[model samples]
Target: ENKPITLLELPTSIASNTILTLLKLITYNVIFAK
Candidate 1:
């Protein structure tokens, strides 16, 4: 079902995207803080 597919695949994509976004944010903060 759609729910199962979303639960399995969505989280992986979302997690990676979230991690990348967080990394970018942190990098920006570090660069601007200096």
Candidate 2:
């Protein structure tokens, strides 16, 4: 029942969040790097 929806939505949201986090880290590094 709920399994199908979890399978479809979980990975995508997780991936997007991960990508957003990485982008933030990269941007922070670039701004603060000496």
Candidate 3:
């Protein structure tokens, strides 16, 4: 039997936002390191 997928099974928008924030932080660190 096939089951339906649910939103809870996937990463939400907040998770993506957090990832973007982390990337930005890393980019800033790299720029400042130079």
Candidate 4:
């Protein structure tokens, strides 16, 4: 059914979004750390 397609697509998109969020947080921290 749709399960296989969802399994293949959701992880990569979710991972990328999570990574981008983490990177943004890190960048902001660095900028404000001074």
Error of 2 at 32 (Å): 0.1
Better of 3 and 4 by lDDT: 4
* Candidate 3 whole-model C-alpha lDDT, 0 to 1: 0.83
Tell me the tens digit of each residue's lDDT in model 2 across 1-34: 4555577798998999999999999999999996
Clash count for each candidate, listed in order shown: 0, 0, 0, 0
lDDT of 2 at 10: 87
Off by over 4 Å in 4: 1-5
lDDT of 3 by residue, 1-34 (tens): 7566468745675688899999999999999999
Cα deviation of 19, candidate 3, in Å: 0.1
> Each prediction's Cα RMSD?
4.0, 4.0, 5.0, 4.1
TM-score of each: 0.73, 0.77, 0.64, 0.77
Residues 10-31, model 4: lDDT tens digits: 8998999999999999999999
The deviation in Å at residue 34 for candidate 1 is: 0.6
Off by over 4 Å in 1: 1-6
What lDDT does the true structure give each of the candidates? 0.90, 0.89, 0.83, 0.90
**Candidate 1: lDDT of 7?**
69
Which residue pairs clash in candidate 1?
A: none
